[model samples]
Each structure stands twice: as structure tokens, then as C-alpha cells.
Target: MRIAVTSASGKLGASIIKHLIKKIGNQNIVGIARTPEKANHLGVEIRQGDYNNRHDFDKALQGIDAVLLVSGMDDPQKRIQQHRNVIAAAEQNGVKKIVYTSIVGNDSETAFSPVVKSNRQTEKDVQEYGMQWVIGRNGIYIEPDLEYIENYVKEGGIRNCAGDGKCAYTSREELGYAYAQMLLDEGNNGQIYNLVGEAISQAELAALINQVYHTNLTYEAVSVEVYEKERKEALGDFLGTIIAGIYEGINIGANDVHSDFAKAAGRAHKTPLEMVQEIKAQE
Candidate 1:
């Protein structure tokens, strides 16, 4: 089957394409990106696939048997229609199967709700489409924390509004493997899987970081308002509020959900310790 992955220039999209190449070979994979040149290094047939442009997808998805729709990063309201453009184009092009990468979040509370709601709408659209479909609600990615280790070290600890709530974190690599399986395996059709790893509290994450990086960093829980203010000061108004909202959801236990990683990927999700160890090995 010929599989097309949208947003192929992105990290998550690229990771999924990498795994797909291993499973099906580059000849059978298509990389769809808004800037096709940016994805040339992926060594697949690159097509221009701007989510806002139905004409682009009309040509891009032509002759493709299946598609992987990576959720868009535009404003939540705008992205709903953008996603539809791709879905409609896929149908027009006679694509047979579609897989969407959704997210796990509190739909009622938090600044992140709009994004979640948008994805939910797209999920509904894909399910109602005249084709086979599978959806995966991804957990919070742990890479940001690992990437921010330098800043955390300088700050002497990690400070957030998560309190004692646990977060089910997964990595792009893990999500990539699962998405590849979802695209190729018909058994996952019509299934919505919560792709998450082991849940752990902020304090536990700090301890793991300490063990892996050999640092004496601590986790301090702060008030939501205070954390929001600090994040705003550091990251500006828009992104800061969104980041704060994610932590607020965590504080409310929205991120601690049952994981279907094993069912989705046909294997167990990697442990947090193993993830950190892999990073250390890479360093």
C-alpha cells in the first residue's frame, strides 16, 4: 500500500516516515509537506500538502492508498477547517484509509481545550468519512522537559502548577512506531487508542532526571496564577498561557489516563528511565 504522511517536514511526521520506511521501504512512502523542499532529505517522493489548500492535497493525495493526518498547529478554530480540507481532498482522491494523530486533554477546562476540541471535531469528521479510519490520542510529550534540562539546571529545580497529579508522557519515537502500525494494519481500523506511557508525578520526573543527569534538581509546585504569570513573562502571552493551561490540566489529573500503547503498537511503551538512558547514550 502507498502511504502518505502530511506535515512531513515536522519532527513527529519525520519520525513516523522513518519508521514507515523501515517497514514498507521508501518507494512505498510519500512525504507531504507545505514546503516540499524541506522534506527532500527524507528520500521519498515529496508532495506539496498545505492543509489550507485543497488543490494542493488534490494532487498530493492522488494515487495514495492511505494517509496519516498530523494535527495542525494553527489557531484551534482555523485548524478545524484546515483539517477538513485534507479529509475532503483525501476522499476526492479516492484514498481508502486515514489515520489521525489527536491528543489527550481536558475538553472542558484549561487553555488547551480549544485545541483538543478542534482535534475532536476532526476525529468526528474522519470517522464519518467514507473510508477506513483510526485515531490515536497522544499523551504529553516528555522531550520538552529533557530538552529544557539546561534551563532547569540553571534554575536549580523544576517549578510548575502540576501539584501531585501524574502525567502520562510519551515520546515522538514511540508515537511514530504506533502510527506506522496503525497505518499498515487493518486490525486498528475504527479504533481510537490512547497512546501513552507510564504516568508519573512531577516529583517523580525530577527524581528520574536526577538519577539520569546526576543533578540535584527539585520540583516545586506553585499556584496556577503565579505559574501562568511567570510563563507569560518568559514565553510571551499566547504560548505562555497555553503551556500554563497544559500544566493546569495536569494539576486536575486530566493527563493521567489509561494507556493503550501495547495494543496500538503491538509492544510495550518504553519506560521513562529507558528514554532518559537512550538520550544519555546519544550524548
Candidate 2:
């Protein structure tokens, strides 16, 4: 079965491609990305393209049986439209199935309460299509927090407003492996798997980093306003908005949740403590 993966340059995308190569062999995989030069070393049939480009879509979908559509990381306003383009191309090209990596609990307006509306619409569009579908509604990747933890522990100051609000963070590498497994299995069609691992708070994460570094990493809880200002000063305004948006998302219980990545993998996913330990060992 030939499978095509979009956004092949990203961490998740690259990991998915690697997993597919291991499971199905390199000959059956296609990696589609906006920049093919960056993905050249992936050693798959590289389709240089973007979601909005119809010509690239036609070329990428040729002779492909299934597709793993990683959500585009462009403008939020254009996200759904880009998905529509991919779904339309898949339908027209007669691709048998599509496994979409969607946001967690995107089906509920209250879950993506702030962003659910668009993701829900995209899910509907996929379901409406004739192709068989499996939705991988994934949670946030904890691996991104490596830098966050490094910043906090290196300076001995951890700042936040989240007090013991547990969050389930999955490793993108493992999550990619799970997605490739579903694409290979063919039994998971029409199923929506909530891909997540252990739940831990920012304070717990700071403690883990401190334990690994053999230093005292302090924690501080500030008002949302102060956190936003500090984050803006440290990071740029755009990234500051995103950081504040995530904390807000956590506060509103958008991400303080859990799911069954264990069942999906038929085993327990890496825990927060385990992940931190792994980072420590690597360091």
C-alpha cells in the first residue's frame, strides 16, 4: 500500500516518514513538503509542494492508496481551506483512505472551544468525502517543552499561572509511530484515537529538570497580565500571544485533559517523568 504524508519537513512529519519506512519499506512511502530540498535526506519519493497548490497535489496523489494529512501550519484563517484542498484532491485521485492528524476533542465545540469550530468543520468535510477515514485527534507534544524547561532551569526561575493543572503531553516521535501503525493496519478506519500520554503540570516539569540538572529550579505564579508581558519581552509579540494563548487554553481546561494513546499503541506511552528522564540521559 502506497502512503503519502504531508508536511514532511516537520519533526512529526519526518518521524512519520521514518516509521513508515521501517514498517512498509521505503519504496511504498511518499513525503510531501513545501521545501523538498530540506527533506532530501529522508530517502523517500519526495513531492515538493504545498496544500494550496493543485498541480503539486495531483502529482503527489498519483498512484497513492492512502494519505496522512498533517494539519498545515500556516495562517489560522487558511487552515481549513488548505485541508479542503487536500481532501478534494484525495477524493478526485481516488485515494482509498485518509488518516488525519487533528486536534484533541475537536469534535466538541467546548473542547476546541476557542478553535474547535474550524477543526470541527474540517472533520465534517473529511467524513462527508467517500474515502474511508481514521481521525488521529492528537494532544500537544511534550518534546516542545524541552526548550521551555531549559529556559526555566538554566536561569533558576520558572514562571507561570497554572497551579497543578495536569496536562497530557505526547511525544511527537511516538505519536508519529502510532499514526504510521494505523495507516499500515487498515483496521483503524473510521476510528478516532485520542493520542496522549501522562499528565503533569509545569511545576512538576520544573522539578524534573532540576532533578536532572542537580540544581534548584524555582517556580513562580504570576497574574496572567504579568506573564503575558514578561513572555512578550522575552519572546516576540507573535510568539508571546501564542504562549499566552496556550496558558489561557490550559486555564480554560482546553489542554488539562487525558486520552488513551496506550490503547492505540497497545502499550503505555512514555510518561512525563520517563520522558524527562530520557532527556536527562541524553544530556
Candidate 3:
């Protein structure tokens, strides 16, 4: 099948393309990026497909049998409009299928409630189109913890307002592999796959990190305001707001989900502990 991956220069998009190239030859793949030059190394047909540009999508999606619509990264309303444009462009271009990268628990209101609501709308549009489609609800990525780790380690603990809440964290690579399989395999049309790894609590995660780093680590439960303040102090306004919302999401039990990601990937998903060990070794 001739396939195209949108946002090809991104981490998840790049990972998806890397694994997809292994299954389908490079000639059959189209790398759609806002800046095509960065994606040239993928050795696939490059197209300028800006999420904000309908004309770009219309041209880029032509001749593609299946397209992986990676979700937009910014303001909720604009992101949804961009997604709608892609859906429209795909339909107009005679694209047969769409595999969307959505978020876990997207049907509920959470820290990213607006984005979740928009994603739900996009999912409705895709399903209502009566076209071949697949939805991959990706789990929270563990990579962001790398930024917060130094603080946690220095303080001998991590502070959060999540109480006993847990997150089903997975790596971008694992989610990418799952998407690749969904794109390459034919029988999974009209399905929703929750691409999550394991639900692990903050205390459990801290202990695992301690085991790997040889440092005494723990979770220091704090008030929401304190957590927000600390995160704002560390990550600045933009990322701080996002990370604070994540804690709120954790508190609201948003990321607490379960799924057969291992079965979908045809192997065990990487654990957070394993990621900690890998990070520790690098340091």
C-alpha cells in the first residue's frame, strides 16, 4: 500500500517512518513534513504538508492509499481545525484509509480536556465518513520525566498532587511501532487500539528509579498549588503549564488506563524501570 506519514520530522513521526521503511520499501512511502529538508534522510518521497495549510495537505496526500494523521501540537481549536482540513483533504484526494494518533481517555474531560474533546470530534468525523480507519490512543510518554528527574533526585523525591493516581506510560518508539503495524497490517480496519504500556504509580516509579540510580527516591505528595509553583519555577510558563496539567490529569485519574499494547506490538512493551536504567547508564 502507498502510505504517507504527516509531521514526519517529529519524534513520533520519525520513529514511525523508521519502522515503516523496514516493512515497506522507501519508494512506497511519503514523508510529509512542514519542512521537507529535515525529513530527506528518510529516503522517501517528501511532501510539504503543513497542518495549517489545506492546500499543502490536498497536494501532499494525493495518491496515498493510507495516511497516518498525527495529532496537532498546539491550541485546541486550531488543532482540531487542522485535523478537519486533513480529513477533508484525504476524502477529496480519494485516500482510502486514515490511522489517527489520538490520546488515551480522550472521551473524558481532563487536563487537556479541550484537546480531548476536539480529538473526539475528529474521531467522529473519521468514523462518520464510513471509510477504512484505525485509531491509536497513545499513552503518556515517559521521556518528559527526564527534565524533571534532576529536581526529583536533588530533592530525594518527586512532588505531585496525584495522590495514588497512576499513569500508563510508554515510549514513543513503542507507540510508533504499534502505528507501523496498524498501517502495514490489513485486518485491523475500523478498530481502536489503546497503545499503552503499564499503569505505574509515582511511588512505584520513584522506587524503580532509586533501584537503578542507587539513590534514595520517594514521592512527596504536595498540594496542587505547590506542585504548580514548583513546576513553574523549573519549566517556565509554557512547558510548566503543560506539565502542571499533566499532574492534574494524573490527579483526575486520566492517564490511569489499561490496554494490550504488547499484543499489538507482538512483544513486551518497554517498562518505565527499564527506561530509568537506560537513562542512568547514560549518565
Candidate 4:
């Protein structure tokens, strides 16, 4: 079956394409990107697709049997319509199935709520589009913490509003594996899977990082206001607030949800320790 992955230049999209290639062969996969040239190295047909442009997606999705819609990174309000553009185009082109990469979070508790609400709207849209659909509510990605290892070391530990709450984290590679199955397996149609790994607290995550990197990092809990202020100072208003809001959600146990990764991928999700080890080996 021919499958298309949107936002192909992105890390998540690229990873999904990698797994899809192994399952369906590169000849049957298409990478759609806002800048097709950036994704040419993926070694598949690259088509121009911008979430904001329905005309471009109309052409990008042509002759495709299914498509993966990577959530857009625009203003939450704008993302709704942007995602609609792709869905509308997909339907117009007679795509048989569509999958979406969504996230799991409370819909009204944090600055990140708007983003979650927007994803929900798209989820509803995909379900009602009269085509087969699968939605994966992705857990918080663990790569950022690994990428910021140096900063954590400099700060002497991990500090956030998560307190003792556990977060279900998943890696891009794992998500890619699950998404490939979701796109290819008919059993996954009409399902909304929570693609998450084992849930762990910040302390547990820090310990896992220590095991991999041999650091003496500790987890420190702070108030939501304090953490939000700090993140805002470090990352500027928009991003910092969102990051802080995510932690705040964690603080309230919004991220500690049931996982359906095994059902989605046909295998258990990798442990946090395993993920850390894999990334370390790559480094």
C-alpha cells in the first residue's frame, strides 16, 4: 500500500518514515514536507506539503493510499484549521486511511491545554472524515531531557513542578515503530492508542540517566509559578510557558495514564533505562 508521511523533515516524521520503509519498502512511501528538498535525503518521493496550504496538500497526497498527519506546530488556534486543510485534501484525493500523531494531556489545566484541545479537535475531525483512521496519543518525549544532559549537570540536578508524579515517556524511535504498525495494520483502524512507555517519576528518570551517563543528578520539585518563571526566563515567554505547563500537568498526574503501546506496535514499550542506553550507544 502507498503511504505518505507529512512534515517529513521533522525528527518525528523522519523517524516514522524510517520504520515505514523497513515495513513497506521505500518505493511505496512518500515524504511530504513544506520544503521537499530538505527531506530528499530520505530516499523517497518528496512532495511539497504545507499544513496551511490545501492546494499543495491536494497534490502531495495524490495516489497515496494512506497518510500520517504530523501535528502542526503553529499557534493552537491556527493549528485546528491547518490540520483541517490536510484532512480535507486527503479526503479529496480519495486516501483510504489517515493517522494522526496526537498527545495526551489535560484539556484545561495548563498553558499547554490549548494545544491539547486543538489536537482533540483534529482527532474528532479524523474520526468523522468518513475514512478509516487511527490516532496515537503520544506521551511526552524523553529526548529533550537527554539532549539537555549538559544543562542538567550544570544545574546539578533536574528541577520541575512534577514533584512525585510519574510521566509516561516515549522516544521518537519507539513512536516511529508504533506508527508504522498503526498505518499498516487494519486492526488498528478506529482506535485511539496511548503510545507510552513505562511511567516513571523525575527521580526515576534522573537515576536512569545516571546509570547511562554516570552523573549524580537529583530531582528537585518546585512550585508551578516558580518553575514557570524560571523556564520563561530561560526559554522566553512562549516556549518556556509551554514547557512549564507540561511539567505542571505532570505535577497534577495528567501524564500518568494507561499505555497501549504494546497493542499498537505488537510489542512492549521499551523501558526508560533501555531508551537511555540506546541513545547513549548511538552517541
Q: For model 3, what is the C-alpha lDDT against the true structure?
A: 0.81
Q: Per-residue lDDT for 152-209 in model 4, tens only?
A: 9999999999999999999999999999999999999999999999999999999999
Better of 1 and 3 by lDDT: 1
Q: Over the stretch 1-283, how does candidate 2's per-residue lDDT look in tens digits?
A: 8999999988889989998898889999999988898888999999876888877887788889999998876555588888888888888899999988877633332213435456667778888998999887777776666766667656667776555556677777778778888787777878788888776777777777677666578767666677778778989886675576566555556666667676566567887778767766765
Model 2 clashing residue pairs (backbone)? none
Q: Candidate 2: how many backbone clashes?
A: 0
Query: The CA-based lDDT of model 4 is what?
Result: 0.95
Model 4: residues >4 Å from true position, as ranges? none
* Greater-TM-score candidate between 2 and 4: 4
Model 4, TM vs. native: 0.99
Candidate 1 lDDT by residue in tens digits, 104-175: 998889987888899999999999988999999999998899999999999989999999999999999899
TM-score list, all predictions: 0.99, 0.90, 0.90, 0.99
lDDT over C-alpha atoms for residue 24 of model 2: 87
Clashing pairs in 4: none
Q: Give the TM-score (vs. native) of candidate 2.
A: 0.90
Per-residue alpha-carbon lDDT of candidate 3 for residues 1-283, written as tens digits (9 for 90 to 100):
7999999999899889989988877889998999999988878899998898999999998899999999989777788789988888998899999999988753454445666777777888778775699888888887766556777787778778877888888877788889998887777788887788778888887887678766677887887778778778988866666666777777778888878676566677778787666655655
Q: Which should have the higher TM-score, number 1 or number 3? A: 1
